[model samples]
Target: MEEKAKSFEELKPMLRPTGVEPGIMKVDPEKCTSCGLCIQNCPFKCLEMDEDEHPKMKSGCVCISCSNCIVACPVDALSIERVYTVKGGFFDTETPAVKMPMPPKDADGTPAEWNEVERVVLERRSVRHYKKKPVPEPLLTRVLEAGRFAPSGGNHQPWKFTVVTDPEFIAELEATLHGFWSGVYPVFNNDETVMNMVGVVETGVFDPRTQYGIRCIALKELPVYLGAPVIVYMGAHTKLNNPALTIGICGQNMNIVANSLGLGACWTNFGAVPLNAMPELKQRLGFGEEWTVVTALVLGYPKFKQFGMVARHYRPVTWFRPGTKTPQTEK
Candidate 1:
C-alpha cells in the first residue's frame, strides 16, 4: 500500500538540520495597528490573533517563509527575520534527477560550457507549425518533469498540469471553444446597449482586440491550438501569491525543455479564458473548484527547422549603484 502523506505537525519532528536560515515573522507592537491583515492573508494559517488582538503564531505553527504576510500588512509592522535555522533537507542532491546531458568538462572539473544552454534559450521559438507526428510519452513526461521543478512563491508549488493527447478529445475541445467564440462574436459589432449588456454579463469589460481574435478563431481564420499533438493545461490555486506568474515560470521551463529535446512548444492563452468560463468543461478536464487555468502549452515536432537567434528590440534599462551620482541608463 502507498504511504499516506504526513501532515506538517507529523513531519516536524523528523525534519533534519539544514544550514539555510529560516524566515520567522516578526511584528513590531509599537507599529502594529491590529488590523489583522497578516492573519487574514496568511496562506498557511500559521498566524492567529492573540488575546490582545495582535497577530501571533498559532501553537506549533509552521511558516514556509513566503513573506506573504509581510506584503499583506498595510502598516509595515510585519517583517521576516531570517534568524531561525532551517531544519530538514530542501533537496536530495545537488544535481537534478532528470536533466539534459551535460557537456564534457575539463580535467580540473570546471563548469561545463554554457554555449548549448544559451543556444537552447535563444533559439527557442514559439512554433506555430508542427509535424503530424505525436510526441512520445517518455518525452512528454520529461517536459512535465521540467515544469514540476519550477520555483514557486514560498514553495507552495500550487499548480496542476493536465495533459491531453487524445486527438478526438482535442478536436472536441477545439470545437467547443470555437462554438463559444462564434456565438459571442456578433456582440462585438452589436449596438452600444447590447455590447454594454454583454460586457456586464460576461467580463465587465470587453476588449475589441480580444473580440477580433475570437472572431478569427470562430471563423477558422486562425488555428485554434496550432494543431499540436500534445496539449498541457496548467492550473494553479487562485489564492496563491503571483499564481499566474508562477505558472508562467513553469510553462517556460517546459518550453525550454521541449526545445532541448528536439520538440517545438508554444505557450498559448487560447484555452485559458474559455476553459475557466465553462464549469462543466473544467470539471471534465480534472481542474478542481479552487484551481484556475493559468495557461496552456502545445507541444509537437516542428514542421520546419528554425536556425539561429532572432533579433529582438532592445528596451531601456536603469541601473543604480552606491558610487554613481545618478542612475545609469542603458538602451
Candidate 2:
C-alpha cells in the first residue's frame, strides 16, 4: 500500500492552464538557424525540430503559454499570439529579439535617463567564473552604497549588510557549504541522476522544488560562490513579514552597480541554506540570532565577458491600451 501511494503521488497532474499548454507559436524558417535553443529551454519537452530545420510541436503534446520558445530564438524567428491556435506556421506574429521599450519624454523633451539603466539591466548576467584578482576597494564600496540606497516599506530600511573579504573565512565557508548540501542531498532525491531531473521537470509536479534539487547537484561540482574574492550578505531580523523583497531590490542594485563598474556579481542564496540550518555558522559571521540571510552575493572580475545577449523566456503580460474615456474606477 505504501509503494502504491508513492506511485500515485508521482502521477498527479499540475494545475496550469488547460486549453493549450503553449499558446500558438510560429517560427520563421527563413530566419531560424536551427540552433535548437527552443528545444533546450522547454521545461515540458513540448517542442522539437522538424527534419527541415524548423521547430515543431512534439507529437500530441498540449501547449502552454510559457513563451520559452519565442524568447529563446536568437534570430527573432519564433512568435506568440494572445489567442490559442495551432494552424499557422511562422508568419503569424513578429517575435523580435526582446528589448526594453523606450519610455516617453516630457514636454521639455527631456528623455528618460533609464535608457542606460535598461541597458545595464538587460545586459546583466550572473557570472560564475572569475579572474583571480581582488575587486578594488572603491568599486566595492560603491556597490554597497547602491545596495544601501534601495527603498523599503514606510522608509523603515530595516536591513543590514555583511561584507566578507577574508580569504580564510571564505575558504571555510566553501567547505561548510559543501558539507551541508552533501548530507542533505538524499532528502530531496534518493536516486540522483540527470534522467530523474528531466522526469521531475516534465511532470511539473515538482516544478519549483525540482529546480532546487537540480541546483544542489550542480553546486556540488561548481563552487557556490565560484571563487569570488568578496561576498556581501543582505540580511534583516525585524519582527515583520519576510524581507526577501527588500533584500532582492538591494541585491539587484549591487549586481547592476557591480556590472557597470566592470565587475561581475552572482547571487548565491544557497550559502544561507547551510548558515540557517546551522546556527554556529551564523554566529561565526557575527550576525545576531535568527537574522534572516535574505540574499548572498559574490563580486570579482569575470574571467570571460559574455558579448551578445541571450534570449530569455518572455512572460505573458496584459497591457492596458488607452481609450478616449478612462474608466472612473481606474482614477
Candidate 3:
C-alpha cells in the first residue's frame, strides 16, 4: 500500500502555552434587576447571587469566556473581561497573508451589485431528493474547510468532522436506527397514554407533522439520510461554551459551501438522536465520551435542479431607537 503524505497536523509544530488565565465576570449593579437570567444561563453554573442580589462568580470557578451570561442579561448588566493570551510557544507572530480578495464595491465604498454569495444564500434549500452520483473527495474537503473556518466562542474551535462515504456502513447505521424507531413507533403512534407518560402532551409539544415525519423515518420511507452518498458527522466538546451553537454555525458554513459547489445538502437530526444514545456505536465511530454528536449533514447531487429565491414566512421584529420611548415593531 502507498504511504500517505504528511497531514496538516503532522507538518505543523506543536504549540505549548506557558500560562493560562480565564475571563472574569463583571456585573453592573445599576443595570442589574436581580432577574437571575445571567445565572440561569451560565453553562458552568459558577455564578451565584450575592447578598444584594447581584451576580458574582463563585469561589474556585473559572470562566471560559463563553459569553452566555452577557447574552442572557436582558438589561445588559453582565460582561466578561479578559483576553486569551499565550506565550513561550512555537507560535507565529507575523500576520498570515490574505488568501481571498475583498468583495467588489462601488465608488461610495458600498456593495457594487447583488453578489454571488448573496445569490447562493437566497437560493439555498434543504434538498431531500438526491441522485446516485457520489460527491468527489476534493469537493468534500472544501466543504470541511468551510466548516473548519467557522467562528467559535473564545476562539476555542471545539469541533470535529467525520466524513462517511462508505455505502455499506451508512446503510447499516440507517437500518439500525430504523429498527429502533420501528419498535417504538407503535407507542409513539397509537398509544397516547405512553406519550402522555413521557410528558409529550403535557409540554404542549404534540405535533401531527412531527409524528408523521417520525413515522416515515421508522417505516424507512424517509431514508433518514435521504440516500445521500456523503454524510458529515459533526461532533463538539460539550464542556465548551455553547457547543451546539458553534456546531450550528459550522454546519451553516458547510451547507453554504455545498450549495456553491452544486451539491445538495440537508441538515439531519435523525441520525444524531439515535447515535448519541448508543455509546458503543459512538465509541466505534471514534467519538470520545467528552464529545457529543451535535449534528450531521448529508451531501449529494440533487435529483432535480432547484434555484431562484424562495419565499419565506415573515417573523415579527422589534427595533429600539435612541429617540423612541417605545420600540418599533415590524409585523
Candidate 4:
C-alpha cells in the first residue's frame, strides 16, 4: 500500500478560538489535472498552483473556508476540513451548493435583467388591504406547486396546504380569530404574567391591551382574509424534525411565487391562533389527525397600488476570523 502524505493536523499548530476554528482546504494531487476551475471560483483568492501545477494555498495564506473552491471543483479534488479544538468535520453535498439557473447577465458581466425571482423577493410586502377579487384556479395551483417543490428535512416533504375560498368559511374564520383576540384581551387585562409576556411593541400608538382590543374590534368588522378570495391554510405533522419550520419554508416559497403571478399575498400567525381554543376549526379547515395548522396565507389583488422600496434592517451578523482566538462560553 502507498503511504499517504501527513495531513495539516500533523503540523500541530496552535488552534484558533474554542468554538470557531480554522478550516483548511486540501487538494489531492493525483486527482487534480490542473483544470484551474478551483482557481477561477476561489472567492478569497487563497488557492494557487506551484511549478508542478498542483493547487496549493499561497505562502502565509489563510482560507475563510467558505468552500467555494470545493463546490466548484468538478473532479472533487478539493476537500474542506473544518478544524475544531476537539474534532474536525465535512459537509454533505446538500450543504455544499445548490443547483439553480444562471441569472441573465449583461455584456459587461453585470446582471442585465434583474432576475424575476429576485425582483419578486425584494418587492414582496405583507399586503393587509386587498381587493375583493378571487385568485384564478390556475394561478392558485401554480402557487401550491411552489410549496410542493420546497426542500424538506430528510426529504419528508411534510407539508399540506388547504385552500379555503368560500365566503361562509371566511366569515367563520373571522369570528374565530376575533374570539381568540377577545379571549386574550381579558387575560391581558386580568393576568399580570400574561401582560408581561405580551411585551407588545407599542408599534404606533396603542398599549398591549389597546392593540388587542383594536384588533378584536377590527376583526368583527372585517371578513376573514380582509375580503381576499383565497385563504391558504398551511398544515404539517408535529412529529417530524422541526416540522413547523418546513411549513414556514413552504409558505415562503408560495408567497413569493404568488407575487410573481401578480397576486398579493401575506402570511399570518393570528389566523392559526384561534385553533388553540376552537378545535372544531381543525375539522372545518381539513386539519386531519396528527396534523396541525402552522400558518396561513391570504391572497388577492392589492386594494391600493404599492410602489417604491421600503427601508429595512437585518439582524446583526458576526463573521468568524481564522487564526484569531475567540473565547465563548457554551450554553
Output the number of the TM-score-best candidate. 3
Residue pairs clashing in model 4 are none
Off by over 4 Å in 4: 1-113, 192-224, 320-331
Residues 1-331 of candidate 4 have per-residue lDDT tens digits of: 9776444353112111112233467899989989886675543455788889988886543344545566556677987654212223221112222223346688899877766677787667666567777778999999999999999989988787789888787887777676666665444444333433322423221222233334444445323355677889888887777888888888999998898888888676667645644677787777767787877899988765442233232323455567767744322
The TM-score of candidate 3 is: 0.62
Local lDDT at 200 for model 2: 41
Per-model lDDT: 0.70, 0.64, 0.71, 0.63
The candidate that wins on lDDT is: 3
Q: Which ten residues in a row have the lowest lDDT in candidate 3?
A: 92-101
lDDT accuracy of residue 83 in candidate 3: 29
- The residue ranges of model 1 lying beyond 4 angstroms of the native Cα positions read 1-114, 191-211, 306-308
Once superposed on the true structure, which residue ranges of model 3 sit more than 4 Å away at CA? Answer: 1-113, 190-205
**Global Cα lDDT for candidate 4:** 0.63
Q: Across residues 144-222, which tens digit of lDDT does each residue of candidate 3 receive? A: 9999999998998989988889999999888887887787667754433343324222321232334445666776656
Q: Give the TM-score of each candidate.
A: 0.61, 0.62, 0.62, 0.57
Question: Residue by residue across 135-224, what tens digits does model 1's lDDT show?
Answer: 899999999999999999899897898999999999898888778777766765554334344324443123323444566667775566
Q: What is the lDDT of residue 262 in candidate 2?
A: 89
lDDT score at residue 250, model 4, on the 0-100 scale: 89
Model 2 C-alpha lDDT per residue in residues 1-331, reported as the tens digit of each score: 4543234234322311122323456778889999887775543455787989788776654445455555556777876643333233322233323333345476698875546766777667676667888887899899999988998776666677888988888988888887766655544444333234334433542433333433443456457666889999777766655577877887888899999898988877667645766777787776677577776999998766532244443435545557745433321
The TM-score-based order of candidates, best leading, equals: 3, 2, 1, 4
